[model samples]
Target: MDSNDFAKFLSRISSTPLRVLDTSIPNSKYIYLDLSYDNSNLEKIDASSSESLSRFVNSHIKLHHALVAFGGYNEIRSIYQRSNHFNINQETERNVHLGIDLWCGTNTPIYAPIDARVHSFKNNKNHGDYGPTIILKHVIKDVLFYTLYGHLSMDSILNLKVGQFFKKGDCIARLGDSDVNGDYPPHLHFQIIKDIESYTGDYPGVCSKNDLDFYLKNCPDPNLILKLA
Candidate 1:
């Protein structure tokens, strides 16, 4: 996909504000938010309880550890390996996170930060997967790349076409419900991609610990554009 055109595309749509969610509700059960997203000790987990179980999986499974989490434009993903389903991408041998997850309530408005063309999209219905997803191609300084917005409402894809052009800051998708968005608390999963590697709606949001080198190289820190933390 052409990324340079995408950079030029983002240049025109600067009217919209990017957003992060206030997930700290009375019963949010997220005690650690007060500390930091990169807290290493929080991940020391016990299988008997659900608290921080997601952290245990995310932290240990991936050797790189949390660089900068939560509030930032850092790509995020929800929980996995709570059970024994092979279809569900678990953090077993692979680090197993493909995109950035933004914590918030359901139907949180998800907007485009840069201009892009619809590279591909799909509704991947596997458990713990992106229920409804979209991928876009963008370019900056003649550099070709792409971004992925997953766990989005299925309705967002309606009337969307492969070649459809979207301006930056446009309302493109909404944070989907658990029933529609991989059965986790509502959030937005975003990722930056240097190359699509022939996948369409389905990209490897999760990667094996062995493959972190390649993924990190191709997937630059999204914070470059999304400084939302």
Candidate 2:
């Protein structure tokens, strides 16, 4: 199937929203967060500092009476400027986020929203990168795809093996703190990939404007399944 068809298939998989976090945490508790350059509120804090960003995010959550701050799919963010990994050049800055980030406290349990088998797992230790990551392969109605979980604790992949199976709602991992999560505040970077190419354990979570069109289609908005609204 094509990208558009795949996205429709994903949305039709479950009428109700799926959960990668605790099923007990209702969707009402998830507040949308905007870290885009257009958000004037970010100027008040040091976006480069993990601690400062954490405080800003937490405050937003508390202000809305929310337990989680979630957003960033296809968002053009300025926080990425602090990392050279994303700003290798001026014209090709990888600032457009490809995943839906769920910002919450560390050690929060992460679950598999659908039946899957481990495709790969790795600890990407680069600054401002996904620290511990796991990619799971899924096939439904004979269409194959993958889901990526990033910023996971070290323990999440210690005993993990390729091809290990996980039923829906199985505890897959826990959130990692900045110490291990690429110097960012605790958050889960969840992405859905229709075609992962030959990548293993890691895929570009952000893309430049020059490549946004391709990335957007290959990595459709994860909310198609999560349906956070």
Candidate 3:
């Protein structure tokens, strides 16, 4: 987790796996597909206007099936504190993404990707926030680290124990519905952390442009494992 080593490590793992699929799929079939789609009824996203990014998935036929499959994570820029923060019962403004979003569709099975123990779990109910979530601890090559899986169904944590172990690629949870999942769409926000820093089920998945340097250090690109960077 040496912030300096992030570039070296992530670059190496980015192209390693090369693909994602259903971890539970024994055949590893249907691993690759064009992910663009539009007007999908999976959630509340209505692609009434073709200009919307939401329609990018539907309007463009070339990217028909490239939804987030089970392989690894896709990178996206995010910000912390850039969005207005307020006290509970108060309102806040816009936010930016900080973690790599695995675009596998809703109810897609999410696996551990590594053998790790459940560090903590929580159901963050904020709009646009991670719905049911679980954070697991891992140590690769003696470097202690953890991964946070957000936007999961509540059942994912049903028998999950704080110290229980999940083998890599073991199905641990399913993508959840909009009611439980944050408002936008269903996807998993997977993050890698060198340290949890006393944070529970929640971590600043979004950071401001100013604080990005600090967050980029704490939360390196998860493609270090997915190798899809």
Candidate 4:
């Protein structure tokens, strides 16, 4: 299926919104966060410091009376400059985020939004990487797609195996801290992939401007499933 058709298929997966976080946490408790370079407020803080970013994220949640601060699909960020993993140079810098991040506390349980089987799992140990990641294969109406969960706890993948089945709402993993989550504040990097290509446990969560169009098509806005306002 084409990207447009794939997005429509995802939208019709369920009559109600999907839940990757706790089901009890109402959608009203989720707030939109702008970490883009355009947010001048970020200039005052050290974006490279995990502690600083954590403080910023937590405070935003508290200030908004929210349980989760989420956004960043297609957002252009400058925080990636802290690690060469995201930026080799100006032209090749992959600063545009391709996923929606749910900023919450570490150890927060993450759930499978729908029925799926483990396709792959890996510990991406590079600086500013996903840390522990899991990709799940989902086939609904015979249209195959994948969902990626990134920045998870070590124990999340300790005994996980490929092809393991998980029913919808199953506890798949928990959020990881800065120590194990690529030195960033605790957050779930959730993405949807139409064509996974040869990618395994990890896929490009961010893309350079030159590749934005292609990546956007392959990885549709995760909100198509989450439906977070």
Stretches > 4 Å off in candidate 3: 6-15, 18-65, 69-94
Q: After aligning candidate 4 to the native by TM-score, how far in Å is the CA of 136 from where it should be?
A: 0.3
Write model 2 residue lDDT over 113-221, tens digit each, in one string: 9999999999999899999999999999899999999999999999999999999999999999999999999999999999999999999998999999999999999
User: What are the models' TM-scores?
Assistant: 0.67, 0.99, 0.71, 0.99
User: How does candidate 2 fare on TM-score?
Assistant: 0.99
Between 3 and 4, whose TM-score is larger? 4
lDDT string for model 1 (1-229, tens) is 3445443443333333332233222222222131223555545544323334445434432443332234322223223444233233444443346455565556777776677788988998877677899988876557667888888888988778897787776777887876787765556778888778999986867665667767766665554455443
Candidate 3's C-alpha lDDT?
A: 0.60
**For model 3, the run of ten residues with the poorest summed lDDT:** 74-83
Worst 10 residues of 4 by lDDT: 8-17
lDDT agreement with native, every candidate: 0.59, 0.96, 0.60, 0.95
lDDT of 3 by residue, 53-160 (tens): 234433332353333432222222222122233112223322335566655456878877767888999888876578799998876667677788888887877777
- Total clashes in model 2, counting residue pairs 3 or more apart in sequence or in different chains: 0
Q: How far is candidate 1 from the true structure (C-alpha RMSD, Å)?
A: 8.1
CA lDDT for candidate 1: 0.59
lDDT (Cα, tens digit) per residue for candidate 4, span 61-91: 9999999999999999999999999888888
Candidate 2 segments exceeding 4 Å error: none
**If both were scored by TM-score, which would come out higher, candidate 1 or candidate 3?**
3
